[model samples]
Target: MVHGGEEALMRQYAIGDEIGRGRFGTVRRCISNATGEALALKTTPKAPLRDPLDLALAEQEPKLHLLASSPPCSPHLVALHAAFDDADAVHLVVDLCAGGDLFTLLSARGGRLPEREAAGLAAQLASALAACHRRGVAHRDVKPDNLLFDAATGALKLADFGSAEWFGDGRRMSGLVGTPYYVAPEVVAGREYGEKVDVWSAGVVLYVMLSGTVPFYGATVPEIFEAVLRGNLRFPPRAFAGVSPEAKDLMRRMLCKDVSRRLSAEQVLRHPWIASCGSDAVAG
Candidate 1:
């Protein structure tokens, strides 16, 4: 569906319980009165703009999601069904992933997943990132929390385009955005960076999924930033004893400190580790 102006938004869906919360809004479970289909509604308050940058980011999110949902992109990406603005807030109606996010799944699985399972998830995510990059969109934040699964099928879907930006021209974007633990070394160093940053973050996601620990750690933000700049990539003996050498090799390629050396999303998708997951590993 195309953009359904505010009237259609309020008239079509019966908003229900709050499912999640973010800095700018709350995500709620809703049901479409017209079709009785379940949906996730993200409502962001239209309060006065205190920080102009925050307002710009809030406005950019829905547009990015819309772009990614268009043709030529992978269906593994979460769909943005519709969006509209009202007197008090803006509502974004998206696909509801009842199976919960990867973070929750990881926690429940004793904080780590077997290599095969992690590889399956990584294959899906790498494919999603390839689609996003092909469409000229960079999903700067690619953490486990942003990965959701379809309840009935257990298919993974990439969610949250709030930190995404268009980079169609192959130009670098500036700004220290993204979670500290997953931020690329170039990004943490305040250097102009491009979609390769997404690859780095995805590598972190892969590492955490397989080993259940972040590559860079510290007691404070500054310390973490320092660790990232130092660019030390390691697979501790205990955590990586069972991990395949090919998996470690792929991780190293994706997390390379030099942006030019870092694997593109497409390359990551073709890496042996991801490719070994097989074509049916993730749903399109």
Candidate 2:
């Protein structure tokens, strides 16, 4: 919205189709009549009661999105422009990426993506994560659904920082948050962890991109937790054919069970597999 808090702006926008919905809100693409720029409007209802933890996270998310957007980086993150809280709902205006998300692409392409394409995507995503980590913003969620790809430029972006946390004073977190399948073992084991958790999730994402399946699978959360704790990734040699050893090594470093031993996002950006993508091709 154009105005400040506690009231919705008078400006009218042509709202497009719904993009996504979660427990707190729904995101819809909109075209601002005043500016003619496409923006994603996320509306979170104000009245309904919710868990205290969730409410706190919801209130903090918009600010974090704003923080990530101010300086801007490659593998563009969705930028939050304005926010207003009314009796009905809290509205957020954000930059729009019309190419949808990685989940949609994977669904359309029969699951697994090609190595070259996935590597390029990984490079872009790594650059974005490096930026976020450098700023001390931890993107707790890093699944396919949270990754948006710009088809026009083949640029992949990290989106939906709803679960993100800012690292003030180098504080580590202890909570069983984030999606079960994508959450790291340290988090699942109820151990204190930091940004490395995101790297682990990114490794799981890379595995999915290359093989069309998650590295760990089970019928229930506990089973998945056990599998993650054991760190048994079933990457048969034939599974990801022609995938460079450097890439696999990097992935192994990311998925390391010990959070302290895991590679930082910046280190991952410099990995041979990522470097092989080339400077011009990879995001800055």
Candidate 3:
């Protein structure tokens, strides 16, 4: 619901230079007028949006994000302080992540991360997804691009709930949503699925971190979808020779073709590799 332009968001936070841009709008750096603290402000204009799904997403994002941030909020999540609305745009104030996203981190580090570091990052993402799942919110899009890092501490935080959906009441969610490289097979097949899809995507993220390549890949979108449908998970000896067996086993369970056999986020936290990195990861 759009909060009538009754309260001016600019009165609370001074909008500054543009920092990033997305499909719907731009993200700018802003500072609180009261405490002199810095934050990020996302402004999405509503005028140009006419598609039903796009409009639905613009409204659902803030609500689902707030639901996931209820009592006992996870630090792994990029805390959204408030959301403001007007006739022109929707404003979202969230914690600033100046260290960039996981994609940038991977690119800077020669396309792959060491096992211990990968485990730590994976554990953090898993913890974040676990918190989202408990609240019945499924983050349909779980990729490096949406995982941001802090400026000073370099801590990881999951962001961008635009593709997230509410799956409460034990109800299954239907619809083809998510990035092709990270989307689950069930999702690609247009099947009704639940929170487990997040685990599958997270598994793909972890696999990419460790091997610097996707498990199911192709030259085109159709080829990639086909490979994902076949569900043949493998660890090329050249890329996975140094990887531990436990890590490989964990990915196997996560990328399993049988949704029932897939492990949940909480179970992923209990995995040996993730468990060993628990101290470094945010609470699950």
Q: What is the TM-score of each candidate against the true structure?
A: 0.94, 0.91, 0.94
Candidate 3 Cα RMSD after full superposition onto the native fold (Å): 1.8
- Over 1-284, each residue of candidate 3 has an lDDT whose tens digit, in order, gives 33445266877888899998877888999998889889998878888788777777877788998898766889899888778877777788888999999998899988899898899899889889999999999999999999999887777899888889999999999888888899999999999999999999999999999999999998999999999999899899988879999899999989988999999999998898788754465654
lDDT by residue (tens digit), candidate 1, 1-284: 43555677868889899999876788999998989999999887868547766566667778888888776557679888788865666688999998999999999999899888888888888888888888788998889889999887888899888788888877778888888899999988888889999999999999998898999998899999999999899999998888899999999999899888899988987887777763458665
Candidate 2's displacement at residue 261, Å, is 1.9
Q: What are the candidates' C-alpha RMSDs? A: 1.8, 2.2, 1.8
Candidate 3 wrongly placed segments (more than 4 Å): 1-3
For model 2, what is the error of residue 268's alpha carbon versus the real structure, in angstroms, after optimal superposition? 0.7
Candidate with best lDDT? 3
User: What is the full ranking by lDDT, best candidate first?
Assistant: 3, 1, 2
lDDT of 2 by residue, 16-131 (tens): 88988876679888888788887888877766636766666667777777677666554556667777765567677877777878888988998878777777777777777887
- Cα error, residue 183 of model 3, in Å, equals 0.5
Error of 1 at 197 (Å): 0.9
- Residue pairs clashing, model 2: none
Q: What is the lDDT of residue 12 in candidate 3?
A: 81
